[model samples]
Target: MVETADLTNHFLIAMPQLTDPNFSQTVTYICEHSREGALGIVINRPLDLRLREILAHMDLEADDAAVAELPVYLGGPVQTDRGFIVHPGTERWESTMEVTDGISVTSSRDILGAIARGRGPQRMLVALGYAGWASGQLEREIAENAWLSGPADPEILFELPHGARWSAAAARLGVDLTLISGQAGHG
Candidate 1:
């Protein structure tokens, strides 16, 4: 067995050869990682739905005039109906998991209510579902060269355009993924 370091608060940039429709060209934030397993959210794949539509569906009142048109992201391929919020705030909400020193994930409706009322965290990314891996699964994938990971940068998460995140995440490792060949070579 190979020992693997926990990748919590890291970003997994999919290699071009990964080719998985759900993760291709994606940048996923590792929220939790351990010997038990790992879980993450894809930060770059926004869904067609808007925060207003979701608020309406949940019967939450929102100050429409105050609510910006926030696009919800497809966190991953798992639990497609569950919602998760990656935000940077000190206020703790129900079902919230502190991913790192300054970042957290909240899956409670109250946070959504706060957002609707324009009183939520200052920066947030609303997502549905998440990517998951069983024990040893992620490490195996890493060994297979399916991903390149680097320290998580909140700026990339909150400031970069969704379409540019994958490349930006890879750049953190000084890697230009575009230059990586799809075929593996043996020396």
Candidate 2:
């Protein structure tokens, strides 16, 4: 059984059998979950795009002098033009979704500006694009063993190194992810 409404702020760890190139070894943070569908950001993959580049393209300024360094992550394949930032919960900007207890996702340009100005949330991950599933879609995948869902930790979403996030997140569930076989069949 799946906990649908409570999926928001949780992490979905891709099962080894998820052959979709886009989701292999992925750790996604659920940003929204409603009857409309589910939306998330992939936390484990980093792309060549940088936060500075994204901000510049959005016509936002990055005050290198005041702003701390930023890291860009590969959110997902959907809406590559759009950007999403996962951060610690804060009230400075709007357009945020509580992804977990202490984590939030911000897409407003104002938040980007604040980050550039060094007034942003204490922790964050800037990502372009996001993973989405239509109503009943994600649930179907999970039932097929395409993913393992679990609660998310603030550190796992915002602080763990990108390459290690998948494994780390799986470990939180007491599962040895490497042992998960990708071959799928009806049990």
Q: Specify the highest-TM-score model's number.
A: 1
TM-scores of all candidate predictions against the true structure: 0.95, 0.88
Residue-by-residue lDDT tens digits, candidate 1, 18-57: 9899999999999999998999999999999888888988
The 10 consecutive residues of candidate 2 with the worst lDDT sum are 62-71
Per-residue lDDT, model 1, residue 177, is 85
Model 2 stretches astray by more than 4 angstroms = 1-5, 64-69, 184-187
- lDDT (CA) for every model shown? 0.90, 0.82
Measured by lDDT, the strongest candidate is 1
lDDT for model 2, please. 0.82
